[model samples]
Target: MDSDKDSRFIPVNDTCNMLEMTLSFPEQLEEAYQIAEKQELIKINHIPSSIATIGMGGSGICGNIVATSAIENIKMPVFSFRDYTVPEYIDDKCLVFAISYSGNTIETLTSLKALLDRSLRNIIIISSGGILEQVSQKFNLPHIKIPAGRPPRASLGYLLIPIIVSLGKLGLFNRYEDTIKEVIKEVEALRTDVNADIPVENNIAKDVAIQIKGKLPIVYGTGEAMGVVAERWAGQFQENAKVLTFNRTFPELCHNQAIGWEDASGITDKCVVISLEGEWEKGAKVEQRGALLDIVKGKGIPVLHINITGDGGLPAIIRAIYLGDFISIYLSALNNVDPCSIGGINSVKERIAPYIDKLNLLS
Candidate 1:
């Protein structure tokens, strides 16, 4: 059966309406922009010499996007910390965005406490509601409260746009103010072209989903923008499509991972390589990407090239991410899995709850 055109399969498989959440991404960005514009300007005594964003999982990807985009745009160094401990260098002069959609992620909450204990005043909290929200209220720290009840992954726009707008407001990032409007329109147009109602013949996402079905997907992203987008692809494929997927960046992959294909007689047949070609890639990196893909293809592994659209930087990243999200959901339909549920992750969290509670890390 062609799951792409099977009207019954999609509705029956998508029990939790994740398709609705994925389709609403453009609206989410629109609303997030409104919310960001309404926020009061943050006041800091000293200019930030460095920037750090603390988060994990879905929420953490926002930081990854920012840190990567900052490479060529922002003057200040940017870091994404996914652990419980704060870097010793994050002092009062480093602007920190501590993001937790649930506000209770153990690592983010622990690090938030560490920042507070150190009397760091440059912290900005982004959360829906949880202990992190309570702490923000208790300390009167600048907090951007997003709408509650969304899965962190589904709340990407809410978790990300505020941080971008905030940085732009502070003069740390200058390109976002105008670029965001264009991104909003572009993403909305993409949604129309790829939504489930569109036939597989007309939908590129569905076509890709059908091609990669039953194969292990290895996503290769080039440059800072697509590197993060590649991570998003792998994560969405795992959590939404309920399959094992892997991601690595180019140039870096050339240094080590490319050699793994030298003896790929058995492994090559079961895998598909998806290369994200970012418009921002330099001439040298583009050559490296082409050479690496050629080597992989020589090993008999199938290759799919997705030339990222948009004028590079934030625009390209957002568009690539939007397309990947749609592809993941379409894949879920083919696999007959509910994209919204993560049974394995939930089981692990439940199993670890007792140990985490005993530690009293929050205290």
Candidate 2:
């Protein structure tokens, strides 16, 4: 049942429609797979020794996942670039995915220009359409087009799956559709549990929102496993809930950030700590996170932990990410903010129109 149809506390979501998109993540993944299958990518006879993806914000997340996943799965070099220029190590021999949810992102365009100037032709574009599409047509480069309209963050499947399929096409990834199907199942299950229509008592996300209300959220996760997911949670909290959020991973925080918490005269009460749970090294009984929990609780601060429910695969990662997304949305409703509105970003773009408004992303 769509929350929009229910009159009980979801009227705000009815107007925004983000709740629908959030709940439809499984369908989005299916749509991405279908679209990727239909895409006609240019043939690359030899798989490049390295891969890099350039993007920012929502589009950049695809690259982050690729870079992180590649570290564990791929022997070759892979990187996700958020800046205007590619690293010196990336040359014509390296394959690049120029991703921008709105194809007009000036940074990505500028980076693409730099690549072209370097005569680097091994690049593919993933976007809905804008200056990127123009560049794609002008250069006759292959491009993948996804649906536009909703927020870029909500279109995770559109931005992510093409990259996955392209890698499979290049023989870099072995399980393409199967991996996607598994995640879709997990997300489907997650949606039912976290839906806005679900009551607060049974909904973990709703429970989280209630607990962290009127407090800053500081999320900590295992560095290698959930760093990107932590960042995702922070970004969602910032954009959807219109709140300041912080994210850090383990060990590194143990050495420095934990000490700062010792003298929490003014900071401890204002913040709620959420430690995203994941597997730790074998025989490491007292994980740094376990120690940090005692440290925070000793200061009389609130600390909570959440873990993924599925097998530790892409499904687990996506499940955790989806949970955070709902928490942010539910928190948005709690704070009376519109989840779909991005006034800060829009104001900046509007204010800088003369210098940065050359391309129409919707076109």
Candidate 3:
């Protein structure tokens, strides 16, 4: 009758087995890169003046990461839309990609419909199978299909590789292939430290889990990679550890979050602040993130510093993600909580079914 025996909590060994599949991403990247190179050879009649990716949850987070990473370098403005409608400025000159891992995601579907209505210049679809795929076929829009079965969060590689490849094909960036290769090497190396075989004494993730036990985690990051990586940590804590956590980006946090911390005395001691550090060129805003961490620590919050290691931008970000993921899983084990079950989310879905039916009928 013990819940720990439930299949949902797949044993650590099983989770490690699953990691093998997830880790195949590096190989997948090579294939994706080749496909993208071929796609680049095919000349499209027209290209959009701007780009936007529409999705929700993990799907949306990927878009945010890409947008932030490319914002400073991309010739056209890149945007991420989490809502049901495309921005007003997204006209015929816009390339709108609907990205939904489940394909049936309401927000993404709605946004896709809106973009179609506007006769957007170019449209791409990324999903497994659902109404999104059907729409893509109906309109002859370009689409990428990902294998189904794994949880959306666990399929980060499938979701991200396509985006990276697509952008490369579009001539948006020339360094993606090398960057991806470097990241893969870095991530493979990290497996030794984060792998299940590594005992708690020497495992960085296990060490982090022990520190964060029973505390409210507040993750902070800077720039595109670290910021999205921070958000990923918060999401992993919620889904994998079933814990309440929050995340905010640097520089921006200084504008508001710094002041709010003053009144949080009761929770200060119980809070664990994780700062994600990355390589920055001269004068980059991230250079000052360490100062922000010092300020938070001075306010009595426990602080943990994690430096994302790698020469390439993509690899550094991936390392940060894998570390956070391992930490979340270990934290769940330390807290004796199931890492996979989300009964609460299922119950909410059940409660909404009746209303959803009624709305469908009205529509």
Best by lDDT: 1
Model 3 Cα RMSD, Å?
4.7
**Residue 280 CA displacement from its true place in model 3, Å:** 2.3
**What's the alpha carbon RMSD for model 1?**
2.3
What's model 2's lDDT at 150? 76
Provide the overall lDDT of each model, using Cα atoms, as 2-decimal numbers: 0.85, 0.81, 0.72
Candidate 1 error regions (>4 Å): 1-11, 354-363
Each prediction's total of clashing residue pairs, residues at least 3 apart in sequence or on different chains, is: 0, 0, 1
How do all models score by TM-score? 0.94, 0.92, 0.85
Report the C-alpha lDDT of model 3 over 229-261, residue by residue, as the tens digit. Answer: 999999989987888999998779988886787
Q: Which sequence of candidate numbers ranks them by lDDT, best first?
A: 1, 2, 3
lDDT of model 1, residue 55: 96
Which candidate achieves the best TM-score against the true structure? 1
Q: lDDT value for candidate 1?
A: 0.85
Instruction: Report per-prediction Cα RMSD to one decimal.
Output: 2.3, 3.1, 4.7
Once model 1 is optimally superposed onto the true structure by TM-score, how far is the C-alpha of residue 77 displaced, in angstroms? Answer: 0.9
Ranking by TM-score: 1, 2, 3
| Candidate 2: 10-residue stretch with minimal lDDT | 2-11
Cα deviation at 62, candidate 3, in Å, is 1.3
